[model samples]
Target: MNQSNETTMNPPLNQESVSLEPSANLVRTIAVRERPANPGAWSNTVAFGWRALLKIKYVPEQMFDVLVTPIMFTVMFTYLFGGALAGSTADYLQFLLPGILAQTVVFTSLYTGVTLNTDISKGVYDRFKSMPIWAPSPLVGAMLGDVLRYTGASIIVVLIGLVLGYRPEQGLVGVLLALVLLNVFGFGLGWVFTVLGLILRTPGAVMTISWLVLMPMTFVSNIYVDPATMPDFLQTLVAFNPVTHLVSALRGLMSGGVTLGQLGLSLLTPVILTAVFGPLAMRLYRRKR
Candidate 1:
């Protein structure tokens, strides 16, 4: 009776062991499933870059500026101020094309910040946060994807300028180099806006602030007029503006007057900007809830 009672109280040892094996295996399986596999940094960045590109597929209108703004600005500025600024539309187109290219690329960079802000506001960032990827992947990816915009704008401006009789004296090589430099500068400058988006309250606010800052930079630099023609104080400001160096470099490269020194300065500007703003933006991004 005692033996029977004990046997009933507890299942056979082999049977109990068998039951526990399934439970242990189930826990181990769950643990394996719960842990996410980490990918390489570059892979993550490229993956997220594709995600950003996919956004444009669903909303083709996002490319409106890249496609249309360059044409409008090239035509308007070439005609409106060409005679006053350079004595004729033909003369001005050469000078204006490079400047217009610079402005378009720079302005388009603002979209990076605006879109980032929109994502944050809509809680899209939260979803990104839950993913098993490098933390800076999203920012880096967005910036990389924006290279398309810069490249498109550069191409459009150059094509329009060509149609309007603006020839690049340095030939295909110089034009390609100019395009490359512009995109690099634009990409680096974009970090400034990324930081703004990370901390700013709204996309509208980011746009407002970006425009307020960019308008003066674009207009007051050597883009539209000779700094020598401006007032003394304005000339001093223009002399120090990074855009002035960039425009000078592009003008030189395209018009066949490029010097090694000018090219160095142009390249250096983006390097400095990226050095300062890139880490700051990443720090701010990490701090974001």
Candidate 2:
């Protein structure tokens, strides 16, 4: 039959109409795109986070560093500088534990960059490129993972101090508050390091940079000494140093004399850090990815 005549013969059913409701067959015909357009970005973040956790599961040492490194630092500093700083070992441990815990948390944040660099070099993140995961997840997830490190590190140091008879006059609540501040402060620092690691070329380079960046921030703070004891310029620096505020806040709480200035600075530093670093990390992370 001629094609024109065949079409004309089939056109007679104008009175009947077909409806278009969504159905399996309709979807198959109309919605054949291979991947979702938006790709459920939040869910992808959760997935990426879960993946990092799973990787950490296979290597427990990723977590153990938090417990061990901080403890070692606390012990070393207490014994090494205790004699000069305080009259006796017992007195030093009590006076020094909180500062060491703060220092430990700051030092502990360095590994965020190192491990993040390790993952990038090992092609661990290459898999992420091919997946639907949100790009910010790895950077953020790594930071979150290290919050555990901060908490664990603080707890270990505090427990060791406790066993050594480093009692806080503020008792249980102070101790708990100290741990909370440590983790929050350290978590913000992790974001800073995590951003640096993602952009840095190598783990060793990241480590070197971490030391350069962290030392001044840690030492200039009131971590191990009172600001009044330092030189005038340094005392001013220590007075304004965020870590010092954190240490002071924790110390004040432990010693049962919370000052408005310490409390204000203590609350502000971590919030400022995370607010500043959070966006920077996300931006750098997206660029690198």
Candidate 3:
């Protein structure tokens, strides 16, 4: 006799009897939120500016030069050559402070390009290029952030000078105006370094080239000595040096003798430098690999 076994199967659960709490971590429907509008160029620029500020915050050592160099120059020159140059330390400081302020800002401006070149070398600019923000915002914002650095350096130089018995004849207003002018010229001069940053392969190279350009500009100008005391040929060369005019303007502003011609001359080179290098920098930035 053959025996057959029957297999029993349970009925499927009824859909009506099934229950799931609304609190369950399961979504039965999809919801879409509206996308926010894109940020404007100014917003983008400010954001990048904040980023630059953050770098300074995190790497406070970045300010070492800004703080130390001005102090060194102010103290060293004030004492070393003070008696020979101007008869007394106090007297020399009065003559030197304004020029030191200008020199400090010009020197500090090189860091802008050094920073840009470092970022580019490390591929930060590549990411920036991929972002949806305005193209020049990074460059503009970095320089804007640097304006604060310039201001800080200036304040340090001024304070040191004040401590050393240097007094501004025009008082607070003159000092403030001089600072404003210094920053404006620094902003314009920064584009030259920005262009260097784009073209140079390394931050070191940018720094080297910047120093090469800066040494002659700062030393040959009326920063340390009166151009009138130099030989006639040297005096003529100093007269044409943009830094010479800037130093003169700054001195005049602080000491209460600035003229319209001096102010105009001080601004002329910066205006021309910005006009020429600003476009050149943009072009190089856009085409940079």
Best by lDDT: 3
Alpha-carbon local distance difference test for all models: 0.89, 0.78, 0.90
Flag the better candidate by lDDT, 1 or 3: 3
Tens-digit lDDT track for model 1 on 1-289? 9997877777787478887998999989888856557789998889878988999999999899678988999999999999998999999888888899899988999999998888766577788888778888989998999988899889988998999999999999999999998989899889989999998999999999999999998998999988888999999999888888899999998888899998888888889878999999989987787
Off by over 4 Å in 2: 1-49, 121-135
How far out, in Å, is residue 83 in model 2? 3.1
Model 2 C-alpha lDDT per residue in residues 136-235, reported as the tens digit of each score: 7767666676776777778888888887778999999988888887787887778788878888998999999999978998888777766778789998
Give each model a TM-score.
Answer: 0.85, 0.78, 0.87
Candidate 3, which ten residues in sequence have the lowest lDDT sum? 1-10
Candidate scoring better on lDDT of 1 and 2: 1
Regions more than 4 Å wrong, model 3 = 1-35
**What residue pairs are clashing in model 3?**
none
Supply every candidate's count of residue pairs whose N, Cα or C atoms clash at under 3 angstroms.
0, 0, 0
> Residue 28 in model 1: shift from native, Å?
15
**TM-score, cand. 3 vs. native:** 0.87
lDDT at 85, model 1: 86
TM-score between model 1 and native: 0.85
Worst 10 residues of 2 by lDDT: 13-22
